[model samples]
Target: MNTQHEFKFLQYPRKNFVRNNWSNLNGRWRFLFDDEEVYTHPSQISQWPLEIEVPFAPECPASGIGDTGFHNRCWYQRTFQYSKNSKRVLLHFGAVDYQAKVWLNSHFLGSHEGGHTPFCFDITDILSESGEQILSVCADDDPLDLTKPRGKQDWQKDPHSIWYPRTTGIWQTVWFEEVSEIHIAKIRLAPQLERWEVGCEVFVEGPCFNGLQLKIKLSCEGKVLANDTYEVVHKEVHRRIALSDPGIDDYRNELLWSPEKPTLIQVHLELWKGETLLDSVYSYTALRSVAFSGDRFLLNGRPYYLRMVLDQGYWPETFLTPPNSEALRHDIELVKAAGFNGVRKHQKIEDPDFFYWADHLGLVVWEEMPSAYRFTHDSVERIVKEWAEVIDRDLGHPSIILWVPFNESWGVPDLAEKESHQHCVQALYHLTKTFDPTRPCIGNDGWESTATDLLGIHDYDDQPERLIKKYGSNHNIADILTRYRPGGRVLTVEGYPHGGQPIMITEFGGIAFVDRKGSDTWGYSAVQSSRELRNKYEKLMEAIHRIEIFCGFCYTQFTDTFQEANGLFRADRTPKFSLNSMARATRGAGYSRGELTSTPQPPPLPAPDTEI
Candidate 1:
């Protein structure tokens, strides 16, 4: 992170589950475009000509260098005081686009390939004892490369229909941390609802972890409820602490996390060597369970309907990167204020800070992977690697209940006809479950689902009666919809069957209302009056509510962005219609509420006629 205070970009520089002894490196940095990728250590050459803020890519206007054109390679250089100590120092990058190589004081550290996952390097050996050190980063990003995951980042010279400007290079916070020789490298908390215990997986890094014991204390409102100590011999250790332990009889009252009341259990972790404290860190977790029974999506053992919106996570100035931490929290608040229990993050793997805010604000999230435009061995390998990294980085957050590996078959287009494509989708579904069996994994959202726990589909039909006719029936699943849908596509592929999974209209109700007359804004169907918009919204939601099989519905968007003017709010976050009306229309009475139903009802009407 650059130490230039005046040029600091990130308001919340610290990463989630943070500790003290950390410094923010998000300020003015010397930047230069390297199209040919010639320079290994660009700092050694002449001074960089351009100055851009760290974490905001050059393509973004907030970066102070709004170069939206194609530049395959770029270098960032900054200097900060870092005195070497007995402990290890780690340099962390929240995320960098495509390929990133780091150098410390002219010494090469290493390179990371994924654009969406956080990566770090131990720079203890290369640090100076007392003086300043030069830190440099080189990123090579190709927007046109279909082999890598690019979610909503337009590859063309200009922002196209749906896709926006590309975000290249560092687009998230960067920081430095000081840790003990044997410190906690990573920790994962999985709440075992049935067992009434929280499973803790701790990964330590050092030459030796012998004689080390991990002491954990779970508390709420300054009162400790459960405490445990486990001896650790291996680098990776797994331990479980029962919430029903002694003195924890009221655990359910203060421990369970939900959208209405998000309660976080403070965790005080300590690493000791025979009574000597080796290291200590602070963390937090929430107890929650997400399951699917027949057509109902269960949250903590009961049916909970998910009222969600499609959040593209874009801003006028920052594009994919938010301008500040306040913006992240504001979005969550807006979702809740506008009567939404959750958000399907669309195709982007968002910053961990967003997830942190969601967890704190009690907003459920469907964590979806960014899509690759084409399907190939390279695309498959890259998507799998990046998605695995993303899962590993964010699986600890309780707000994230579902993992969506694909969206509308953006990459695997021939899933219905090609056998290999079906196999690929199935492979990804099983792969996600293998990593995290706790969360339901959606193989491909919307259509052509090979293997998925959640059956999500997209429909933008303007008429409410048509939607009611399409889904409200009691016949075979294949006969539910016989004609083409709003976008001229089948509801489900030919061979794939609804295998009793929880279903949702993950994308729908994109009612377009343009505020400006001359603007080129549009939606699925344009409405001229606010009253019409409200009536349409209510009618559509009423149709959705009548279908008991649907566990949830996600409207097209939260706000208007670029050419997509179908948001409930404008691009600047101003309400397009009355907030109360939108809340009433999209959220009809108890259907939109997150209230849990103890007894799951039977599925909705089975078959539908083709006409409205």
Candidate 2:
């Protein structure tokens, strides 16, 4: 095996999977890069840095490196020692963007493609006791390649608009474990509200698990609600447990999960042959219902407008990782503070930590499948594998409500073939529904809106009246907007970038002032005064309120990024607007109350990065 890695500190289910002396391998490591070049052995590295963190890439600040140029290849190398009693050593990488090839101690294990999924290797067959083990990886990602599902990743050195710079190499946690032959590899939780049961499939690590015993326990808070024991005798194992009363009603009355409240219950599982326990894992879930009845979304059977923002989960400092859990918590909290019920996690399947926070914070999430740069038949397989991992891993969380597959055909090279593209979306839609029918599946966020469960619109105008002029009436524009079936909910996610409320001003109030004070930029820099900003925002809100035609409306942003200055808060998480006033405005109250006289800001802030 390569070596033993005991990251006990970062272990989840902290009570059971405690890692008391875990070390963070997130610093400098030697590196090299070349897409066409192949160096299977770490000893054969050429023209590269010596080390980088296993999870954070060289470009991100957290990785201890600056920025990697676009359209480049990257390689990383590291060494560690293996200890005794480590019968089976395994290497685990939380996530690696683009493509990666893994090697341990001069032995070739495997390679994985896709930037948003986690992969592992079993090093039991090849380990040297107390000897240095070598690790090598190579990654290739082109942020500008629209053929892939590159969400908002820009190819340029600097980012602008919605597109941000690409993250390469390892941008997640990496470690190793010493596990036994008979252990649980993964747990699949499928909650079926209709059957009042939760279906499960446990994947065992080694071969021949037929004699192994599987134990499961479900609970609310710390109190156990249901328990079951079974035997796994097949390559693929499945189990179902029906609850007497599947809902939780401890004074709270069957805890319902919504943006207003998020409740999660704990679940524990173990594997054993008889008296010997193999592996045990603790997880959590929330009892909730999300469905599409008739033409609207019903959360607990109530109509809800999914007010959401386009959250890419990228940061200027950490690349992908938040500065800390508190940072993650802060983002979700800020979204809620800005009057958004949910976020459309654009083009990235987030880490569990992000999801955990989202669930607890009561913010809804629209999870999307990250796409590759190029499209091939095998792309579907890769998408399926990564997406399956994402779905199963986050299934227990209650905040996720919708799943998006193809985004305006980013990774869909066959988009020219309407029938074929339609098939892809349809296939994914069916797959989504099959997994969790309790939730609605959005086939494509802004593809046609007709093919999906709800209609998503991206329109922009400098004037609110223009929106009414274009989509407000039964004219030619409305004919185009309403091309699809009539039942789907029509929503304007992005439209003409107006200054804010016209007759009044509402919508997103960014930290343009700070950007002007610090960076000088904006989503659209046409205003000249804070009063104009306030007016513009109020006018947009006024327009939204006046029409009442949108399911819900979301302004451009919540905070500042690298260069884009359209945030209500600085990039450092400090509030830009007077917190009290921003909150009051976000509370759905009318801003400006009536016609306001204010000069518009002329030299608008520059657009940061434009991501797809």
Candidate 3:
């Protein structure tokens, strides 16, 4: 195996399960748009007139075909060389929008739904005798379909208010790998911070055999932490490996993960049949915990205030797909440099590379589901299914602190009056908790929240005085929640009270400053000069810091997306003001000196009733 090639591919694609020998099929591919949906199979298409860059959708400029028109169907074809070997071949797709049907050498491999999750197919038996394989894909994404979780992709011919161009076909990496017949299929790591142990579940796939064993080794830096071996009788094995606990707080703090210090424990796994090593892979995880205690958000068992920015995860060249792996790391770096410890990924389920970078770089993330515009049985089923896949794919990442299933009642529009809509919100919340009981879940984020662990309000008042007057004290907060509506919507539904959940202003401060010329640009408020923008930002931060009710806050945005010029930086990621100035404003007076303390504890509130 080429060590350099392996290193290059392992850095970005699927950090959880990585092997030495694999192939990255991410270059040019034959592409064509089929609006009529006439061709059922790859053989029916006689010609491929367009050449598109893989992983980048056609609506973006990086795809080499920047056509943002309404095309529901598209086709892709490519060829690669592979020889029959003792190892089994697996073809993997990072993601494909809406629906996708794949074919290898004109033979149907499989089909996958949901645009945000990954799927793979075993192609070992379909390899051609000539050592060449032809791969084809058909992606069908209806533009006007309101039942699918479309995120911010606009359905109209032109981009509107908060929505941008539609991302049609493949928008993520496509690769292949070779594995042994009996290899480790999957693994889920659960870190027990209090017990000083890591719980691991390993899934094995292949023909049953005797004398199979699995070995796991964990380390940090150059120091070995734990090494254990388990006998594999069945397919899945679960065990908790204990780590030597340092009795001192300072020593244990060194091992814990936080925004100030990110320590990842490197993981290495080996599968053996008797003395023969069948497979080996490398991964990493961190020990971290996030929860709420008496109206305060706690990180690593201590109260921690979250200064987060809303990240849409979009680019000028690539709509949803990142231009490269380095870009993903760069975005996280920029967020941290601006003095934010976390980010609320707005709608889209971002690429795995983004999550990997955040995990490695010590940035907490709130993973939100893309919203479907309409409410229906099909919409509910689609969102629920896709949300499950999302949770499954991101369960192991320690950086993801919260799961948001619905945002501002996008799908359940009648959440206030209709019993079915109310049930939908409660169902998603409970379902998310069922899937991931470790982290908190927010049912409806912005407003009209029915069942949620956190009460998130969206207020773009624009005036610091008004913000202070509105949320200066607990009395004001109570009035706002009960009587006054923030964005013309009640904070919680009529039947649901506050319930003593920690409150946070999830959306605010969308100050637009048009540094460049663009007629389509808009924001909640406008500033004429950079100085004015900086001053306004400083005042807003000051007011938010003064608020006694908010446990944390997420600023409107991190970077300027298309037609939404409310970001701290321009669309190209150039800062409107100096980094130091922005950082100072973001971290108000005495923030670095640890003047901030936990919010006042409210009376013990009863747990929400399980029955809806």
Candidate 4:
């Protein structure tokens, strides 16, 4: 299906899981900007007065070039039709904002500089056997580049405070992949639900790899359980496979995945030279894990509290790009119907169809890393090579399960007396545990923390008996920085030493709901009704549920992005308190700061391109 969107929008436009070829080079192109960054592609411009729209972002007004200032060069042209006969076409690019340069048919064909991962280019001898083929793209983007990661976008000209507009060129989805040069380049999937098993690395691409040959399956609804077959002999291949891998033993431990049951399993590899199959793909995974214990947050091993929220994956009209895929499954079923079992996607690196609708609707992502507010050496080599290709393209997503890699200290701000900013946050927390050593790798989230497994903090304290006397118990780190975090912001950065882990108040209650209307209605305490926003959100979740040394809390968002109004909805997502009173002030109520719970409300969730 080659989507050209004039707007009946339901397009996931390929975030991988292709079976029958693939095409969708989004719609209406031919645009021009070149604010002196000097034209480099689009066959050196030959009059394209402006049309914009492919994967929206001409500072999006559904991209008819709303031009919200900051230009920095741009050009995009389109024309497509391949009439298949592929040997290796491959031209995908589901992202492009910082630097991109391509031209096919006019032939230049390559240039990608990480605007949030996904990149490709093969052009198979610049194909031209039948009709149409033009495809051009040029983007440069630098809204005052702080060395490039540019998350909450905006660098002045309009949107402010926690940044907002400024995205250039193709903002995701522009495809054309019909591979067969011995395909399947990459698929990690570690899994292992405490050894029920599943390793599978696989990374092939043409010739040598000892005559190829690999197959694997692991179904769910169609039921084939698990199967295996290997012998690729090097192009990176690992293996494990085993739910009980011989015939799958009647649901052994029955398909586990959580946030209250997410399940998934389906994958299907295939590639062969010795048998002529050549290549195939269609993936899926989840058996979930997410560990950490002492201050607790287990998951398949039990505890699991994280009622998170921070979601800055914006979209008053596709800012960080996502207005489809059922508005990313209605923003993960409206954060699991306002009770939040997870979502800390804060500095934005979202849209893999929002981690496939948060792994098929159960939700629990954290996956942060999108900063670069300048710390030099090319912003730590563009944040460790685009945060290790966005954690190797979202490490087999079992709804993410945490891997922040620097937040609060925006881009290594004197990381506690800089030893090269604590060796660039301990080399992005040991390269995010050497690419997914089973999730949870904070290293720098909320406060000044250095190497962390989770000790995040950012207290906005609208008093709930002073957040129950500052985390109700253990107090070290200069009395948790001058008695319960008094703005000196310290959590653990003087040579990292709070090793009990799990402390997440990852940015506290932003409050603000006073009559909404924006000119930046801001937050961090504004309430003037909805019964004082449910009595200060049930007294700040009853002081993090009577302390017990706090295991989780993310709030400070989940809508109202754009001059951040302390959203608990309302930035056009209504609900200023009442998804069953904000899911009983965040799930399973009890310690009541008194008078509220009437429960019933649940209706208003429709307009995400309507349907339902």
Candidate 5:
């Protein structure tokens, strides 16, 4: 990763040009800790401790302060000096787990709330003329609060199964880059290969970019199609241009980006004042699409099954953030070793490096919105605001295919019946689609299914015959599952039943093999031995390993959390189940001598659409 050229990392394959070139701002930074004053304003920040790497969360091993305590909030301070010729200095944060406040050289920049979304601030005016300028940030996260999106975080001080320690502070890269004040802030690029069209919207921030000539181009296989210089006098510009012949079929060798291909097209942007180039920036883009037909999801317009694993994105050594880019690569390698086509990133939006690796490794992501606490008028507003930001900020990535907002109704229980809550969920889904129509949104995962694109639910039983009986002809959801469940679901079934149109176990196979002989864990049930759990799990795996009706299934998880032991890997990134065994069971390569009901059992099956 270090030897890769700078342009190679910052580019995204849009139509002919790349999106904003601000993503590659990564490097070393200073460190400090304060309650409030130090972060609210950089000037009030007093002397502090040593320097640390930016982007790497303090909890991560690569970060200088690894394995730190969370009782107190953390403060990050950094100083940077840029040349006067620099057009603009923008500070970008890939993510912070909770709430964060930013200040530039004593000037208040901005404050944001939300743990898994990215935020940025324009600091062109706050930089010094010649020397170092201090950058301070304060982060506060209370995992036990249950008011925010703290997914599977241990309620206790120490971590255990099913729940990991919260990444309480800055967990992603933080850096600043210089751009023209009125330069391109963000670009939403959509490639329609079927229609030979490329739609784009440019978000502007300054004067020079308002009315200048913005030249756009589309290219592939080292060949350019269209290049036009348009005028944009406002802060935002929307444009859609038709490519001569969407090289989709005409091009000899296609750049169909996938984990295997991972081909990228270079995109260059230039702001020209007549013949003079006012600003020149480099980026890249990929040509891909994700959609859904009936209950089956489609990628590149073709049906694709999601052979995935539950990606909790946690490491005992790093908590939420990986130690470095290499650590990010290591996680991807682990997923590939498991023989999964993708990862269902449960509740957390990981660092950019994680997404980068997913893009390179060709991993599809079921990007779920982090689950939050109970929702009221105020809390719902906060969650919605964060959702919008996350959607917009991450639209450039090709890895994300589905957006899941509500998981088992953790924060919201009665949204399907409430007009306002239902409206919020529907509105966010619509907004997400309007921003990036490339992918289909799951709307909400499990339980309450309303006017959503897909009907997703969870169950624990493995009786495929039972699923065919209940959903096949039944007409109501009331008889399927009970509300008493922590995460409600349809009638329990283990196999991937075919009668249930686009059915997915969604949640099951959490066969934990961890033994906590002397430790107390916060679980609804008492601790069980790894041998006992794995035995039960192998039965479940044997049931679904070859029954290929369901779209896909995500096991309880990839790693152990606080008290939830249904993870393939232990809490410390060590595999509990042999990787070789996992590879065989996951890729439809294993079979058990279980009964395959040729005749119907007394019990029933499941259904989609109406219910039953």
Candidate 6:
């Protein structure tokens, strides 16, 4: 394939289960709004009045129909040529907002809910005998419904305080892949840094066969580290593969993964049944560990201070969907250029491409679930279900260091008083830990925390002196948690007192610079010029660095998202101030203990044994 086509296919919905051959069904598609809910099936829609760009919501300018008005329901139809062959076809949707029902050739395929996670269907049987196949989708998203996870989407007519435009339907990639009758369905790689081993779990689908085997290969820099094969007795197989330990710190550090040095261990897997290859996939992972030591966050068994920026993953043209794959990489580059070692993906499960780049470019990510406003049975169920899928989809990425299930008591609004709300928070926290115990899980990020591994405070006070005074020492922190409440919300729930977990200001410093004239924008604090912004930012950094108790800090945001113009860069990604100035302010003289340094380049590795 040519470079453009290759790039298109490389935008695979899932990074872990990637295949070389696949079709990109993105470009233009027939579209229409179904506000009246008249069409229940694709056959009922008589005419297609509009065309929309796939993966971009109708509310976004890139979708061609940039109507930001309230339209709860919409329809999409597209046809692709597919010749029936020996292989089975699987259709995948990266994500659809709220709820989605799909049909192929007017045949009812299936339905999926939860806006942030991916869902797929086996479309082999539903394909038309002819070369062309018709695929239709009906997305029903209630704009006013607060019971579903909406992320930063506003339900109102226009963009509001913090929420931007709504992403209605097909906000992520849509494509299909051809696979054999039996293939690898899923794979999960868990890094056990302490033991110098990696736990591999593979799930296979199709008919049960006696001679099915899975071949696994691990390599780094063209040197083979491990090559093993296992007989598949059942659908799921788990094994721990040990790596040769380089006892010296210098040699071992090269194998470990950090934001400064992202050394990925390339993985190759092939499913075989009696010498016939059923499936083949290529993936990568790294060795890393995230933990807490008293008031410090430990990475690779050492105290590593986190300087993270809040990224909403929004663009001027595309609301939630990135315009292109390169945009995702560019965003990470921008974050690193600003001197932030990590990013808190605030209130949204970002596209897999974002995580892919983060893993490759060596940037830490805090994956957070979007919030549902109302706390109800349905809301709880929806958040829990989607959150699991979120974890399941992106669990293998080495860049992710933390899992944030709730933010600032969103969804569970009465968490401070209601016992049920507190239970819900605890439940979600435990659920996240149960799903993936490798990383630390934050129950409620901002305030009113319960059953949390970390205590995250979201104090947007722009005053640096007040911040220092609030979190200067252990006594001040304890006092603020018990007596003084930031944002009029208690730091922890009534029963769940501060448990001495590492504390960090997960949200702060939302200083808005009005780059666009008369744009009706706002932030926690506004500045008139770049100099003023720089002065205020530098002071805040200085204050944060002086705070001996804080383990880390996440600045308000990375880009100006809609009306909430509290970003280092504008919506177009142009920096508000000079990049060097921003980086200097972000890094600030140095940490009290020591200065942060880039990962040293690894020396040449010794030769490894040839694979059998």
lDDT of 6 by residue, 1-612 (tens): 466655544666666567866887898999999999999999988999999999899998999999999988999999999999999999989899979999999999999999988899999988988989999999999999999988888878888899888889999889999889999999999999999999999999999988899999988877888999999988777999999999999999988889888888888888888868888887788899999889999999999999999999999999899988789888988898788999999988999989888888788999999999999999999999999999999999999999998898899999999999999989998998999989899999989988788899888898899887777774666686887678999998888889889888889999988855778887998999989988898899889988888899999989999889989999999998887778887887752222233423332221211123
Model 3 per-residue lDDT at 492: 88
lDDT (Cα atoms) of all candidates against the true structure = 0.81, 0.61, 0.87, 0.75, 0.62, 0.87
lDDT of 2 by residue, 1-612 (tens): 111322233333112222222334555678755555565466676567445654666777666666656645677877777664635666777777777778777777898877777788887777666666766666766555544445566766687665666788787777776666777777666566555666777777776845788887777654666888877877456987776663454543354566665655556777777777666666556666776555356776677765566675777777666666567777877776666677877678776667767776677888888765466766666776677777765665678887777665556544434465556666787887787666666665553432456555554345767555544544543454445321232322223111121110113333255425545465654565656656666565555545444555555566666666666666776765555455445445543422121111112111111110
Model 4's alpha-carbon lDDT is 0.75
User: RMSD, each candidate, Å?
Assistant: 8.4, 9.5, 6.9, 21.3, 9.7, 3.2
Q: Comparing candidate 1 with candidate 6, which one achieves the higher TM-score? A: 6
Candidate 1 lDDT over 354-444, as tens digits, reads 9878887788999999999998899999999999999998988889999999998889988778888888999999999999999999899
lDDT of 4 by residue, 1-612 (tens): 224432222343533354445567888988888898666656668898989877888887888767789788788887887754757888888888888989887888878887877888888788777867888888887788887888778787888766788787688888776778778887877788778787888888776757777888777655777777778876767888877633353454367777565777877777777857777776778676788898888987878778888888777776778867777777777777777778888887876888876777677888888897879998889888888988887788887887988888888888878788888888889888987788879888777777888788888878989777776766643465445553466667675667778777887888877474545677768877778877888778877877776687888888887777778887667787777677777864541423222112222111222110
Candidate 4 vs candidate 5: which has greater lDDT? 4
Q: Give the Å error, residue 421, model 3.
A: 0.9
On a 0 to 100 scale, what is the lDDT of residue 187 in model 3? 87
RMSD score of candidate 5 (Å): 9.7
Q: List runs of model 5 lying over 4 Å from the truth.
A: 1-73, 140-145, 154-156, 159-161, 208-211, 221-228, 231-237, 244-255, 258-263, 415-423, 462-501, 515-539, 545-549, 571-574, 577-580, 589-612
lDDT of 2: 0.61
Q: Least lDDT summed over 10 consecutive residues: which range in candidate 4?
A: 603-612
How badly does each model clash, as a count of residue pairs?
Answer: 8, 73, 0, 1, 44, 0
TM-score ranking, best first: 6, 3, 1, 2, 5, 4
- What TM-score does candidate 6 reach? 0.96
> Which residue pairs overlap in candidate 3's backbone?
none
Model 5 residue 195 lDDT?
69
Regions of candidate 1 where Cα sits further than 4 Å from its true position: 1-16, 245-254, 474-476, 481-486, 591-612
- TM-score on alpha carbons, each prediction: 0.92, 0.81, 0.96, 0.36, 0.79, 0.96
